[model samples]
Target: MDPMYQELKEIEHRPYPLQPSPWLMTQVWRDLLFMHYPVSTDIIKSYIPTELELDIFENKAWISMIPLRITNMRARGIPPVPYMNSYLELNVRTYVVYQGIPGIYFFSLDANHPLVVTGARTVTGLPYKHANMSFEKHEETFHYASQRIHTAKKLNVAYQPGHILFEPQEGSIDHWLLERYCMYSFRGGQILRGDIHHDKWKVNRAEAVISTNTLVPFIPGEFIGKPPLLHYSRRRRFFIYPLKEV
Candidate 1:
């Protein structure tokens, strides 16, 4: 049997929290920037299996971004400040699970809060039954917001699509950078000097890809996790909104 094939098979059989050597970080980055892949990196930052304590993954890479959604427009109410209609801000948070270069991106859609309003349903042809709000990562969801926000005044928007770069000082990135990347920004950057134990390493690739395109980019109504769990619930859901055309 070939050595590479044997190793791949071994990794496939292993558990999620694969304790890769610290050196795995160096190798993975090199492979990414150089576009040389099919390399296994269990020694660096192995796949996170179960919910880990925050301390264990401190300074590790994470991402966070404001999700794309629209809020419902409220009807005008008779008020002291007359002739004014209220609008709820439809916004959400998204997380990006950084893979070597092209990371697997997952969207967290909240089912209870839907941007688009379908007519209330009736089970037995009577009045509305239980209300159902579901969020989805579907192509339709992408267009949903534009339609809802078309009448909304553009407040503040900042998102850049396409090849961008980040040069972390001693592998130390700014907290805002990681947050924009849709990951948790703790201590600024993930691969710090302590995390790397090296002088400099280049990241040739950094992407958030979906495992399958069957679903929408992100639906905001889904099960996040049980409450009272700090680290568990903080993670934002991710969805691939259509990339803006260059």
Candidate 2:
């Protein structure tokens, strides 16, 4: 048995990931466009951070938490830019919490701010580096930018702001622009993967087996590995389609 497995087996249970609420849906969407998008003479200045205050050139860091789900997946690889592996290798702290409904919302943190959310997905979580609104990937014109666009569409649909105001701050911003928009990536080393000291198990051993084997590759933890004799029941996966938005 693997030592990591032995240690995981010792633990009886783990905590569940936090879920997003209806209010959160309203807030995230409004921020992404009205807050993050850099446009001149914006009315929503109160919500937007100041450029002078943002040390975008200085490499000031912060965290952006994107509350959404993963829709597409691909092996970590490079595109037309060869000789480089393209993964969501941005140096930052990222957390994905199951919304308990359907999708998982991702929270990204860096030296810029504490918790600035950037984007979200509906059918699934964003592919590695796919959700980083600051990356050139987001700016690319021809590629399947569909992921983020789809996510943005979903957000627009979920948006239920009865009186939400979109504006930049009145005064010159004192924080990083990405911090305000939660759209940028970190500039330094990344956090360790195994260091994800989550104590709660999202699925039981039996269920994990079916998940790892059938759909995605199983990430070995402590105990549950071999396939179970019976299939575990699951809830209906919820999705907020972007194309359906008004």
Candidate 3:
């Protein structure tokens, strides 16, 4: 069996929120990095919709900056579209709970693929922006950068993953952040959800040097002056279901 399909067969580690199979889309996430910063709970409350509650750990809310390469993207039973199959992406996201189910709420997603940006905005109502981006790996480190076309919000970072990769233990912060299976969006006064699924992340501690990070203009740059918690994963094959109102 294909490794991706083999992943789907092992579901004991997955949470209960997954929508049933016949998932509408699939993609491969490569060289993913997660940079997490802690923020005051009060600071995040105003941004989340009233329909959703902030999902905090300990007593602090978290914001994660994710940089990744997306590939082999295609709808169920469809071949990969030539110009749309691959792209570099940067995401600003936070955690939220909707109707007792914990999930992610993206502040904004910037990608280099024009078709993807337009399609995501139109179809999922996600805040997707087109950007000029570059990605390359030197030795063992990944040098990733992106600058949004509309607003020159740029992010440049170089990171390398440690050799010891392991699954995040349940109840650990890594599990809390990376194990989420659904994403929520607020548009036109309504909340929508897109459910996603993949196997548990096998990640290693990552070392990163961030040179520029004004990707989130709404938040002050000094807010993350302190180093963030970092984790790196080589790849994951993901399946996504349709977006529906919650």
How do the residues 1-246 of candidate 3 rate in per-residue lDDT, one tens digit apiece? 123476677678777845665688889999999988887777778877878999998887888999999999988877888988999999899999999888999988999988899998999999999999999999999999988997768988999999999889988998998899899988888899888889888999999988888866445456544346899989999888998888
Question: Which residue pairs clash within candidate 3?
Answer: none
Q: What lDDT is reached at residue 184 by model 1?
A: 24
- Local distance difference test scores for all models: 0.21, 0.20, 0.86
Top candidate by lDDT: 3
C-alpha root-mean-square deviation, candidate 3: 2.1
State TM-scores per candidate: 0.19, 0.17, 0.94
Ranking by lDDT: 3, 1, 2
Q: Is candidate 1 or candidate 2 better by lDDT?
A: 1
